[model samples]
Target chain A: MKRILIGALFALPALTAMAGDFTASLSIAPEWRTDNRDSAYFVAPPVVPVQHRSARQDLGLRFRDGGFNAQGTLRVLAREGQTPEQHGIVNQFYYDGDLGNGSGYTFGRKVISWGVGFGFRPLDVIQREDRRSLNPPPLTGVPLAAWEHFSADKAFTLVWTHPGHRHEATDFRDQSLAARYYRLVDGNDIHAVARLSGRHALEAGAGITHTSGEEWAFHAAALYQQRYSKTFNTLAESGGGILAAANPMQEVMRRNGLKAVLGSQWTGTSGFGVLVEAWYDAEGYSRNEWRRLDALTARQRSLNGMAPASAINGNVAWSSRAFERPNLLRENLLLRLSHDDERWKPALELLVTPRDGGRVITTRLEYQSDRQRVSFGLRFLGGAADSAYAQAPIKRMAYFEWRLALL
Target chain B: MFKNALALFASLLATLIALPALAADDIAALLKRADGYRLLEESVRIETLVESYRGDTLDKERRYTVYIKPGRRSLVLMKSPAEAGQKVLMLGDQFWLLMPDTQRPLRITATQKLLGDASTGDIANMTWSDDYDGKVVDEVDIKGRRCLHLDLSAARPGVTYARIGLYLDKASKLPIKADLYVHSGKRAKEAWYEAKTVDGQLRVMSMTLLDDIQAGRRTVVRYQSIVALAAPDEFFNPAALVRNTLAGW
Candidate 1:
């Protein structure tokens, strides 16, 4: 940690030429929802569930000079019936300096993307993501040290990352490392990457992308992970006599797993883009397994008053590592269509878990007004009552966000 | 006399049809020369003002500063209007767009539209000799200005357009007009280039792009204060894209 801290101090130059270029932005969004998931757990069920509302505020600042740049964000969150919480996050703090001879390194917290897929990148094995918002933020970055060297036709990269706030590393020798090699072949960008991390897990992936003609853009990526989790189920504390004793989060087994993504984008002269992606996650549950989760959720909902007495009933709520969780199914498909222009953008996104028939639809409209942006969006989730998305407490919601960038 | 006159007419017709085939050797050279006149220097800085209009209404007006190393790299920084802090960086074939508030630059496709009528390809690429093969097809006069009509095709994949039709000034060999087409030969857009003498060298002053798919929609970009200045590679990097002081407006 001290070495990384010293590295940051080295990025600041004598004159600080870019200090005057600093800029700041503020965003305020108030949300209203029809089905409030918070009420399903935090509040007691009665004649009427409280209307769910929240006010979210965010502030951002950035500064860059020469090869040094720093950026951070602050969030002020308040629920309708809860006290406000303030959190600070650093998005990127790094220096991109050349080390002579075509080799360079970016040492700090930065997002290093590897895969070619749009919505779901199988090779984007970054360890963190925030699923709390309507549109879950992109992956959270890690403290990293990277070395890269490349020429016109070929390149190589190595990255080392620290867990930061994560304490799961079993030993002091827990160092995460990844390496990638990329080459341009017949107008196609092809790359392969391998990663070594905690718990003796090994991961490798490869991807290809091309946009030869203006008509369409094509990409495909496949990743394989060793010792992957098959399920997050385990035994639980006993509460419902002798019938409901096993209800806890436990790894059933570990084995090799594969994930693949295939996608394409169609570009039109009218400035409209249609993107389609098909994703497969072998670590996810099958249709039959989703049925079990659905049954459990239904059982929990039925036992509303008696839920506290039965640990099995409580298992349904304890499953999610975080809220607004991703669809847990074997296969999924995504279709998105949007207009690309300067000021106003309108878009529609549809995601489907084909094997379980679960679906999510989102419609959004955004307006950019010099230094400020405002957006309104609505989301709907549906499927068989027992499916993943349908079993979730929330069914429909709408949100708006307004932002101003003051430089 | 009639037979002799018939032979002359036949010879002229043959030359008209055979001109493009005979000029193949000069095609590559002419394309390279045209590119050189625009690229002028290995590294350059250009200030641009873009105005877009749809039908009878002005849709948008924006300004930007572009730092370019010809075919190697380019950094486009938004200067005025609502998106002042936005920036775009292009290196080799990779493209990244950085918004003022976004965590990092997100990868973008070259075919995506940049403004009203300019695509990412049009902004990312400043040279054509490396990506296109040109062949002079016909010599004609457009409103008293002698022009050479050239047919250009993509020499490699990943290019923004598969085919282009260019009209160059016969006297200076500078580009006057161009039409881009898709793989199936469908016209996508038309451009008119304007050039003027800057620092004793002919340089493109402004470009007007007209949408072929949508009638009555066009964008005009005028270049200002173009200078030959060397910018470090870090100036064109992804991190530098967010540097608000790159050009200092």
Candidate 2:
């Protein structure tokens, strides 16, 4: 705690100098959505009611002048009948400096984007995302320091997350450290990253994106990761517990696996962009493992009213599989289309599980001017009762949100 | 008969040889004078508004600002439409496009699209003399004024246009028109430059581009508030570009 305070204090001097150079922005978006689900079983809001209404307001303050900059956001959330709650988060607050010789550094809380995949980036290991909609809500930043160097066609980035913000069980070495080396080849970018994480074991990744002329583009990314190292997949049979039916296993699975994405994008002169992608998760549960977990979930549900809370907790994992794994199913195929022209831009994304026939279709139409944006979208989930997407509490939802930036 | 044939062959050979040398000198002079009209060593703060027309309908309209430092660096800030707050930075052969919401700067090619018909390279690349090899091809007259037609080829790959046909007014040496050709040897697009006298020197005020593949689809980019200024080294840095601070402004 003391070190964390000191680290935060470092920003104070820079912040004080730029205290008056701040800009404020406020936006409110009220949304209405509908779904079809049983009201009794909907205990909490991983999913909302069949009919729901909410108003969300965002307030942002940014300070950037001289050599320092910071941005903070506050969210005010209100349900139709529930008490309003307010939350604060730091989008990104960092001090940027040039060290000469093509070197620079940023120190503060900031979100890092590891461009691993188009829609689903499995290698974005630092973030445990909130999966509610197709375009998930933004993730909060972590306190860290990053350094980067650029020379010719090559760039190097070094990142240290969870720097001084810690309570127990971790020293500086236990923090996550990541490094990336990027090179330009034939006007394309090819990058490789290696990470040493305390929670997760060693991870290595590589990605390449190339545009072949003006009409076609191709990209591929892959990551090698250890299984079940702080990774939660509730639909998979937990290999760590001691039960009669359960097999005793290691905390980290011995079989390290690969997750990969291969995709291509094409754009027409008439302003239509199309993308097709294939995603594979080698660490995903097999059919037998899924069956076992399904049985366990059924058993847990059957004992829900009869068993006590402690007994239910004894089960290794029990919850909806909607948020589990990258796709809950092994093989996923995605097709996305977006229109770049200005008159009512429309976008669509479809995620299909080939083996299970589960599909999630999301489409949205939006109008964005210089200072305002209004959008309407629909999310439809379809699958067999036992398939992946059908397990979600909601069947379909339609919503509209409009935001006007007031500064 | 042999002697007469030799004499004719020698005369034809001399004419062929002399034609190329003369063309080379003329092409060099034309490029040097055309370079004065543009391709300067200065920074410009201008809003390039593009309005594209498909048939009678206005298909797309947008605006943006590009910071050009000639051979040193290039940067772009999209001001309106969908991708607002995004900035693209270029240093040498390296290019990175920073989206509005994402944290990392995505590496992009120079030929990538910024708005309709206006490529990133089209706005960023200032001087063409270094990147293209050219020769005068023909002399034509239009509207009672002589014009020199030239063909230019890219010296490197990944340039926006593999080949370009340029026409310049013989008197003022001002660029009149150009046609960009794709690798398939098809005329992809054509551009017409409108010149205006600014501070007693002729400068391009607007460019009209028409897509060859999609007939009736055209884009016109109008330049506003073009001024000559020098940018410091820090202005070209990716870090500074993403900051969007007053220093960059």
Tell how far residue B105 is off in model 2, in angstroms: 2.6
Q: What is the interface RMSD of each candidate, in Å?
A: 5.0, 4.5
Clashes of each: 7, 0
True contacts kept of each: 0.20, 0.19
Best candidate according to DockQ: 1
Q: Ten residues in a row with the worst lDDT in model 1 chain A?
A: A234-243
Model 1 per-residue lDDT tens digits across residues A1-407: 33433343354343244554565667788877666353232222232234478877766656766667677766777777667777677887888767755567788877666666766767766542322246443234567888887555566778887745344333223457888777767656687988887643798999888664455778899988875555444422222332244545555435688889898888675568898999887767777665554444445556756556445334554544213335367698989999867568898988898876788888889988667888999988777655676655567878898888655
lDDT of 2 by residue, A1-407 (tens): 33433443355446546544544445566666554343112234433322377777666555665657667767777887687777776777778777877678888776666655676665565543423254344456667788887665567878888875443243223467888777767667787887777555688889887766556778898888753332233334554332223322223343477778898888764567888999877655544555555565556556766766444433332344223445666578899898866446798989887776778888989886646778888888776566556655556766666655443
DockQ agreement of candidate 2 with the native complex: 0.19
